[model samples]
Target: MGIKAALSKPFAAYVHQRNQAWMQQPAQTQQKVFTSLIQKGASTAFGRDHKFKNIQNHADFTQAVPVRDYEGLKPYFERVKKGERDILWPGKPIYFAKTSGTTSGTKYIPISADSISNHINGARDALLAYVYQTGNSTFLDGKLIFLSGSPELDEVSGIKTGRLSGIANHHVPGYLRRNQLPSYQINCLDDWEEKLDAIIGETLHQPMTLISGIPPWVQMYFDRITAKTGKKIKDVFPDFNLFVYGGVNFEPYRAKLFESIGKPIDSIELFPASEGFFAYQNEQDDPGLLLLLNAGIFYEFIPVSEYYNENPRRLRIEEVEVGVNYALVISNNAGLWAYSIGDTVKFTSTRPYKVVVSGRIKHFISAFGEHVIGEEVEKAMHQTMQKFPEVEVVEFTVAPYVSPSAGQSYHEWLVAFAQPPQDLPAFRLELDQQLRQLNVYYDDLITGNILSPLKLTPLPSDAFQKYMKTQGKLGGQNKVPRLSNDRAIADALVKFKVES
Candidate 1:
């Protein structure tokens, strides 16, 4: 009935119809998208190096370009940072997303003109798809809150450089900017704690209908609001209905979030990264987001099973099969050619090429050759919470303890709890047992006495948050690593250990 809803209805219909067609011939859509990108950037340095002119087919393209990671692409990025035009894209990138993970200390990822469109339009389509499907369009009539990074962009050789949140913040259209909560002045406060305080002060009494943020920061906001007003989140924002979150798995945080809301609401899972907006959940019931075939990003999959092989197979969209774990690779309009984005995924629907995030290639516990992954660890936690409904995980990270400390080397878990299990030892045992079920290599490691049983360490009350804060990674897309290759992060958490 609202003006925004009335207008968006047709737009949503258009998107749904187009998506249906795209799904019918996923390979053809992908071919057209990628061919266009190749032609567009043929004169650029990367394209020339890879002989894109001769790449008439996927086979030729594969032979021409070797896969690369951030470090492998660093040389080109260095030239880009110096304002070189046609070094990657035809012209200079409009901005760069500055980020760091446990693996890469710092990365300045380019965002081309086409890449900006992909991100902004992809986000709009994802939201509209949900609105159209659920027949609930009133959320846009009221205020929308996005817990995001500082919008203050610093110039790098005349190109904007900042967090991806800041990059996104800069692109909100004027009309939507009017409905967005927390004035621009407050949204660009720079410091996470300071920005949260400003956000609380500005919008606590406003009529907010939608909120989007990573789960950890959103949890922090919910807790603070509950403490401040003595009301559940649903009561505080009576019209709140839509919650959009990504960046980390939402399973562990689901129970706690709903408990804070005091009601069920529709949620959307997104699969985006510093490189590109890869996929979005179009259906309410379907857990997998459609691997967008026409998003100006070419898709490739390296089976994690063969990722370490001397001659690992790189499978394209048509070549991928359902139920296989793959390290996702993308060559996008952003000029990142044959780049490995690091996150792993599994195909849930091959017809439309839909996928669910499986884990990360670098994020695992393989210190004892067990090779336990994020998916396994997450499932273990999910089961742990299931068996003991009284306990809820606030945040947790696991690292392989390969040291002979006290003559026992095992998996070390650093956990902070909102409400802990009644029997902590039983909870630890169940988690370890679940991992044994999830992975045979891990079970073999235990059976062969190569590694001891998992170790459980109860972190101080707010240790995860405190540790993240200390690392300057407390909000807006920064996440604590769930699994570390070494005790570097675990040792840091030990310092914040709650002496039980």
Candidate 2:
């Protein structure tokens, strides 16, 4: 191992040991975070509005501050954007992470000085945890590339504002700066294709050991690398050992990624967003990400079944049960109080508080009361593909097809295939069967004749990519939603469909 890897071993061990202290007592750690958040919030304008002084405990907190999405908190956010002090947070945010909102046009999530460490530390420890567990810090010796958004920032009331990834670019640790690849100028390029080509040109001959990005974007980089070098990614970057990814589930893209690399590699999955860095995969063999309880964030979970209820019971860390889908609520030092980030997660392990991102709360199919989530669809796709080894999926999305020329209403799956299955009908049957097994509501609808079995639409290659390009969301944390309740996306996909 090189000097950097050699030095990281001892520090990695120390960090791992420190992390275990809080991971073992998750509820206690969370309670401490809750107390700290409440104390800090008491000094903000939101605290006065919500009667934070009267709040004593978690139950009191629920009563004082209702769970809200971005729109619900926009009034205070607007004040902060207008340079108001102590509006939502204790003071004006250091930066506003501008994100695309579904209902609200655009969201500006605040990143306070106190909460920035949580974002930076979570990412750092994820790597250190891997180094501690596997004694594999060799990647530190070579180029570590993060395929992220532009580092450029515009000012909003004198505070810097940009994409969360772009804001994070300014915080890359000093030690790793030497190993970080793709010149800053290339990262600042607005067009993804241009930035990608620039990234390839810069790193094509470098000793790239770690490449981090959303899986699809990374796949594009891999594709470009292979096209340029006329060799597998493994041959071009012989030392590349770690593939760090977030934003989407890696299973669907796993096969294609490994195929391009010509071998399997270890990966670290992160559960990060504009709001905060929530979790990171610690163990190489574990699929569950270790939730960061001691971070400056207090977490709550409302069961998905009860999320829409007038008074949904918000469960604290100790109350969460394994395998139950819960809408993740957070109150952090960043001043987002009892805020619903819209993501749902399943607790896989409670001992160390490990969770897997189940789906987005809004990104579900409940058109006919048969609610299906992202996790269920991804699993069904994964299982069906396992049986049909030749089938290679590029991307896919499901939307309700309520009206059909013939027969009952059915869910329509639009799939872009890298290698289309030989027997499309058989493949569709298996895929439908797997989904039915995973989701009982879907199964019941099919059996009750209320809905027909799902129909598969084999889309032209690059259909999803083309759609994303058209929407100006081609890369950098932009992903196609796995489930849609309406036909908007499906109707748009029709033009890209392959005719039988």
Candidate 3:
């Protein structure tokens, strides 16, 4: 191993020891975080308005602060944006992680001094966990690339404001600064395609070892690299071995990604967001992400089934059960109180609290009461792809087709394929069957003639790319939703659809 890799051993060992302390007593760690958050928040303006002083326990907190989304939290956020201090957190946030919200057009999430470590250390620990477990820190010796939003910041209330990834760019440890690639100037490019091309130019022949980004965008980078050199990524960067990704499930893009790489490589998954860095995969073989309970954030969960109720029951960390889908709610040092970030997750293990992001709370298909979720469809797609190796998918999405041109209504699946199946009809039928096995509601609808067998709408190779470009979400942290209840995205894909 190189000097850097050898030096990481001691640091990795230290991180493992520190992590073990909290992992062994997750509930106690969370209680401490909860108590600290309440104590600090009690001094903020929002705390005063919400009666935070009386919040002696989780039950009291629930009563004091009802769960809210971006819209509900905007009142205080607006004040913070206008240079207000102690509005949300203890004082003016060091930065505002600006993000595009579905209902609220633009959002500015606070990043206070106490909370910044959560984002920075969470990512750092994910890497250290890999080093500690496998004892292979060779990747640290070479160049690393993190496909991210522009690092360029716009000032708001005298505070730096930008995308979460952009904000994170500023916090990269000094040791990694020389090892990171695609130069700051290239990263600051406003357009994604432009930035991607620039990244390829800069890292094309570098000794790259680690690549991190959302899966789809990383696939795009891989595709561009291969297309440019007429060689798989392995040939271009022989040492490239580790992939770190978050935002979307990697299963859907796994086949394509590995195909581009020309071989399987190790990867670490992270659960990060504008609000906080929540979890990361601690073991190479484990699919679950170890939730961070001591990250200056108090977590809560409302069963997805009860998320829309008049008063959904918010359960503490200890109250959550394995395998149950829950809308993740959090109160963090960033000044968010009982905030729902819209993502849903299922616990794989409760002993140390590991979870898998199941889907988005609002991104589901239930037009005909089927309630098909992202996990179900993703599983169906993954199984069908495994069964039909010849069918290489680029991207796909599902939507309820309530009004078809003819016959009974059915579910519509828009798929952009890298390699189309030889037997299109068979592929469609097998995919439908897989979905039926996963979701009884969808199966019942088809059985009772409430809907027809799902239809497959082939899309051009560049369909999703074109769609994302049109929506101004072409790259960076933005991603296409896997499924939606309404036809917004489905209808948008119509123009790019092709005859199968």
**Worst ten-residue run, lDDT, model 3?**
399-408
The residue-by-residue lDDT of candidate 1 on 1-500, one tens digit each, is 67886788888988899888988998898899889988987999988887888888877877888888999888999999998899888999999999885566789999998889888887888998997898888888889999988778999999999999878887887768889977889877768888898899888989899999999899999988999999999999999999998888899899998999999999999887889998889889999987788889999899998987876788879999898999998999889988999899999998777899988898998887788899999999999899999987788999977776543789999888888889999999999999999999999988888778899898755788888888888777888888998888999999988777
Give the clash total for candidate 1: 0
User: Candidate 1 has what TM-score?
Assistant: 0.98
lDDT to native, each model? 0.88, 0.92, 0.93
Q: Highest lDDT: give the candidate number.
A: 3
* TM-score, every prediction: 0.98, 0.98, 0.98
lDDT accuracy of residue 161 in candidate 3? 93
Clashing pairs in 3: none
Q: By lDDT, highest first, what's the ranking? A: 3, 2, 1
Q: What is the lDDT of residue 442 in candidate 1?
A: 90
What candidate 3 gets wrong by more than 4 Å, as runs, is: 404-407
Residue 18 lDDT, candidate 1, scale 0-100: 84
Q: What tens digits encode model 2's per-residue C-alpha lDDT throughout 50-85?
A: 988888999899888999999999999999999999
